[model samples]
Target: MKLYLQYFSMLVRCQMQYKFSFWMMVVGHFFMSFSLFFSIFFLFSRFGEVDGFTFPEILLCFAVVSMAFSSAECFARGFDVFPRLIKSGDLDRILLRPRSVIFQVLCSNIEFSRLGRFLQALLILIYAVLTSGFAWSFDKIIALFLMLTGGFVTFSALFILYAAFSFFTIDGLEFMNIFTDGAKEFGRYPFSVYGEGILKFLTFGIPLALFQYYPLLYLTGRSDRIGLIFLPLIGFLFLIPCYAFFRFGLRRYQSVGS
Candidate 1:
């Protein structure tokens, strides 16, 4: 933890040297993310709720997913750029360090720019809490906190799994965005809105729904099972297999000749 803080401080100092570039990137991310909000806004303005969900409820769902994705991207962008590290043989340095490779990779890069989206998510979350019609309580707060944390861990695990695949291909796969970015987009609505089969697949297979749908049902009073409120914890389980897969990939890593 101390080492991570040192790395973080150094990274912040380096980013400070390029304040213009950093702020521009932050603004860029803010606008890009706001596009999704506008899409939802226009939809609600016209039709006024879809699938028995109100605009405020939809905003809450969107904020949760966006917050998770933004948080993951802020700290886990290193995994997203893993292919570049491998291609340049920079990962060799990570292997040589006494620190854990995962920690090294995590500290390799941190994107404060992504916090623009995080702030946007937070603003929406505040509004959602005020207007979503669900009375907040201690348990509800805990459930929401768990959902955000679970979302961060789940999305980070996905990035780890995606990095593993890069070991075989020696190139970054764009299609993996179908899970990461696609999940954030579709997650604007509860995955249950799609259908039972899709919901089941998200719950048990990809586990994207672990942080979104079931717990939401409980939050909105649609489900009586209090167990559902804690389902997001299962997302943490996803990290074990993902880390094991990443280790398998590490064993297979082959350096290119300079």
Candidate 2:
């Protein structure tokens, strides 16, 4: 933990060196996400409700997923840019460290710029909570915190999965964005609004809805199933397969030029 803090502190200092550039990147990130936020706003304006979900309910879902994703991007920025590390042989240096390879990989990069996106999501979350008409309770609040934790783990696993794939092909893969970025965009609404098929996929396959939809239903009083509130905990299990795949890929890593 101390080493992690030291590494994080170094990154903070590095980002501080170019204050203007850092602030510019933060602003750029905020606007980049603002476009998506506007799309949601326009959609809600036209339809009022989406598949039995109110605007505030959808906003809550969006806030959870967006904040989780942005937090993952912040901490797991190393995996997002793993291809560059491999290409530049920096990953080789990581392997030489007397620590777990995964740990080293995780510590490779830290993106402070993502804080802007996180702040935007947090603002949306505050708004959603205030306007969503859901009576707050202790259990409900715990569920909300669990949802955020679960979402972060799920998104972080996806980032790791993306990085693990780089071991086989040391280049950027745009297709993977369908799961990462696409989730952030389309996740503005509950997974069920996409239809039964997509909801099933998110529940059983990706388990995104486990964290976003089911718990959300309980929070919004759509369902009194206290059990559903804990469904997000299932997302932690998703990490098992992701880690297995990463282990498999690491064994196949050929050191770029070998």
Candidate 3:
């Protein structure tokens, strides 16, 4: 833990060295996300609501997904850029280290600029919470926390799976973005808005909806089932399979020989 903090501090200092570039990146990312927020605003302007969810309710879902995704991108940036590490033979040195590979890889990169998106999402989350009209209760608060945590875990797992695939191709798969980046865009609305088929796929296949849609229903009082509040926890189980696959790939890894 101390080592991780040391790495974090070093990375922060290195990034802070370029104040203008760093703040530019931060502001660029914030406005990029704000554009999506505008898309939602315009959609609601015309239709008022979609699939029975009001603007604020959908905003809450957007904020949760954005916050979760941004957090993952911030912390799991190493996996997101795993191909670069492989290409540069950094993974070889990482493998020789006494530390856990996952831990070392995690410590390899930290993207503080993503905090802009996180901050925007948090503001939207606060706004949504205040206007959405749900009676705030203790359980709902817990459910919201779980949703954020579970979503972060789920996206991180996807990044790991992306990295694992790189062990085979030595290049990152673009289609994997369909899960990572794509999820962030699609997730602006509840998964149900996509269609029942996509919703089921997200639930049982990718488990995105495990941390997103079901818990949302409970949060909004659209459903009375207490089990829904806990569904996000199931998303944590997804890490097991993703990690197993990463290990399987590690065993077969051949260095890029760079």
Candidate 4:
């Protein structure tokens, strides 16, 4: 942990050296991300509700998804650019380090510009909580915290999975975005709203619904099942396969180099 902090400090100093470019990236992220919320606004203004979800309820869902994606992109940015690292052979240097390669890669880049999106999502989350007509309760608060945490880890796992795959293919894989960015965009509305098939796919296949949909049902008082409330924690399990796959890819890399 101390080593990570030291790495974080150095990265911050490097970004600070480029003040204009840094701020420009922040502002650019802010404006570009604002479009998602804007589209949601226009949609609600026209129809008043999406499939049975109130605008506020939908807003909460959107905020959670956006915040998760932004948090993942900000902290795990090195994984997002893993393809570039592999192409340039910079990944080889990290493998030689005494520390964990994941740690070194994570510390190599910190896209603080993503904080602009995170801040916007935070505001939306607060607004949804205040205006969504749900009374505050202990379980509800815990559920919200878990949703945020679970979402973060879930998205980070996706980033890791992306990085793991980059070792096999030098070309950029656009299809992977269908699961990462695509999930965030589609997640603007509740998972169930997509229909039973899509919901099943999200729930069983991707686990995105573990953080967004099931707990949301509990949050909105549709169900009081304690199991449902804690389901978001299942997201942590996703890392096991992702990490194993990464290790597998690393071995394959060694074989290719040999």
Who wins the TM-score comparison? 3
What is each predicted model's overall lDDT from 0 to 1? 0.91, 0.89, 0.95, 0.87
RMSD to the true structure for each prediction, in A, is 1.0, 1.2, 0.8, 1.7
Q: Which stretches of candidate 1 lie over 4 Å from their true place?
A: none
Global fold similarity of model 1 (TM-score): 0.97
**lDDT score of residue 145 within candidate 2:** 94
Q: What stretches of model 4 exceed 4 Å from their correct place?
A: 254-258
Candidate 3 per-residue lDDT, tens place, 181-245, comes to: 99999999999989999999999999999888999999988898988988888878999999999
CA shift at 112, candidate 2, in angstroms?
0.3
Model 4, span 10-58: residue lDDT tens? 9899999999998988888888778989999999999999888889989
Q: Which ten residues in a row have the lowest lDDT in candidate 3?
A: 249-258
Give the lowest summed-lDDT range of ten residues in model 2. Answer: 249-258
What's the ranking of the predictions by TM-score, best on top?
3, 1, 2, 4
Off by over 4 Å in 2: none
Q: Please, what are the lDDT tens digits per residue for candidate 1 over residues 124-165?
A: 899998998788888788888888999999999999999998
Compute each candidate's TM-score over C-alphas. 0.97, 0.96, 0.98, 0.96
Q: Pick the candidate with the highest lDDT.
A: 3
The local distance difference test score of model 3 is 0.95
